[model samples]
Target: MRAPKSHVRVALATTLLAGAALTGSAAAAGFAHADSSRAGDANIAPVGRADLHPEASPLFSVARRLPKVSADQVLRLAESQVGVRENGYGGGTKFHDWYMNSPRARETVARDGGKVTDYRNAAWCDMFVSWVGDKLGIRPAMGWDAYTVSHASWFKENKRWGTHPVRGAVVFFGWDGGKLLHNIDHVGFVIKDNGDGTIQTVEGNTGNGKVEIRTRPTADVVGYGYPVYTA
Candidate 1:
C-alpha cells in the first residue's frame, strides 16, 4: 500500500522522539508536537560525550558545516536531476518527478514490477545529490545515506545525533521502536524548530508528494540523524 503523507511524517517524528528518551507515542504524538529547541540549542552550544559503543562509527562531524542550504536550492537541485524512465507507482506530486528518472534507478525498480515515479524513493536523494554536487561542484552524497545509516545505529548504539537537528540534517525512522530497520526508505529535513516540542519538517512523499512542510512531534523522536559533510 502507498504510504500516506501524514503517516510518513508521523513515522519520522516518532522515531526521533523515541531517541530523545521520550516514552510512548503520546509523549510526542502527531506532527504538531515535535520540538526542536533541544536540537537548536545543541547547535548553539555544541557538547561532547564519550562514544558509548566502540565498534559503531561516529555521527557525521560536519552536520554544522557550511550554511544550511535553502529549500529553494534543494528544489532547484531536485528539478535539475536526470531521471531514468521505468515503471511503478508514482508516489507523490513533486515537480522534481520530471528529472529524477535515473537510468540505473529506473532499471532497478523495473525489476520489481515498479517504475521510477517519485523523488521520495526513486533514488531521488542520490539524484538530488548528484545535481547539487555537479552544479556547486562539491562532493555528492553529502554523507546523507551513510550518516543516516550511522545515526540509526547511533540511536540503537549510542543514542544520539550528537548534534542538533538543523537544516539539512537527515531525519530517519523505522517500525515503531526499531531503529536499525531504517532503510533510507523515508527521509526528511529539519526546517523549523519550535520550542514547544513541535517542529516544521520539509519532507518528500509528504502531503501527497508536493514536498510540503508540516509540523512534527519531537518528544517521541527515536533518533536525530545527520550526514557527514566535512569542509
Candidate 2:
C-alpha cells in the first residue's frame, strides 16, 4: 500500500507462503461488506512504504498497441509475465509505463488525490492486473485501475463480485484474512482452487516484488471479482 499522505502503507506479513509474508476472489458473494477503500494494501496507497529509493526515473515510453484477445487467452498472457520485476520503487515494467499514460491513470488521480507522476514507483500489484487486461484487449470486461479497492468496487458496482474461486477470476485479498473491504491487501488472478482450502495464483508485486505463482490459504481472500469474459 502507498504510505504517501493519508494512504496507509502495508507491512508485509505471512498471509501467503509460510515463513514469508504478503499476498483474492470475486464480487461480494461471500463478503458481507466491501467498501471501495478495501481494494488491496497496494491498492489503497497513493505511494507505498517509504520512498527510500533515489528516484532514477525512466523516460516515459509509449504504451504498446494492444492486440485483441479472448478471455480464454488471459491466463496464458498472464503466465507469460511470470518472472517480470519492478526496477525497484515500482518504476520498471510495461505495466507502470502504460498506467502512467493511460486515461485510467488520470481518472484514478482525480479521485484518489495524487498526481499522475506519484505513481511512478508506487506499489504496483493492481497496475500489473490492469496491464494484463489491456494486453488481452478486455479492459472493459476485464477491468483496470491502479487502486485495487476502486477496481474491486467497480466489479461490485457492475454486479460482478462473487465468493467462489474460478479460473481467471480477479481475486481481492485482505491482510487480516477477513471479509471486510478495508482489510484488502493485494490483488491477483486465480489459476485454480487446490480444493484443500488453498489456491494457486499468479500475482504481480509479490515475493520480493516479482510476478510469482503462489499457494495461499483461502482465509486470506476477501473475495473474487468476476470479469465478463465473453466480451
| Predicted structure with the largest lDDT when compared to the true one | 2
lDDT of 2 by residue, 1-231 (tens): 322442332222201110001002222222223232322322111111133111111000001112334445778788889999988766677788888888777655655676888778777888888888877666755567776766666666544567788788889988876786556778999998899999999998898888989998888898887654432
| Cα error, candidate 1, residue 197 (Å) | 1.6
Candidate with maximal TM-score: 2
Local distance difference test, candidate 2: 0.62
Cα-lDDT of candidate 1: 0.37
Candidate 2 regions with alpha-carbon error over 4 angstroms = 1-71
If candidate 1 were superposed on the true structure by all CA atoms, what would the RMSD be?
13.2
lDDT of each: 0.37, 0.62
TM-score result, candidate 1 = 0.43
For residues 1-231, what per-residue lDDT tens digits would candidate 1 score against the true structure?
122232122222222211111223323332223233334324422222344221132232223333444434544454443242223344332323433343433432332233345344432332333334334422211321212343244344323453355554545543254444344344455565677876666554444333445677664344454433333
Reference-based lDDT, residue 86, model 1: 27
RMSD of each: 13.2, 15.0
TM-score of each: 0.43, 0.71
Q: Sum up the clashes in candidate 1.
A: 34
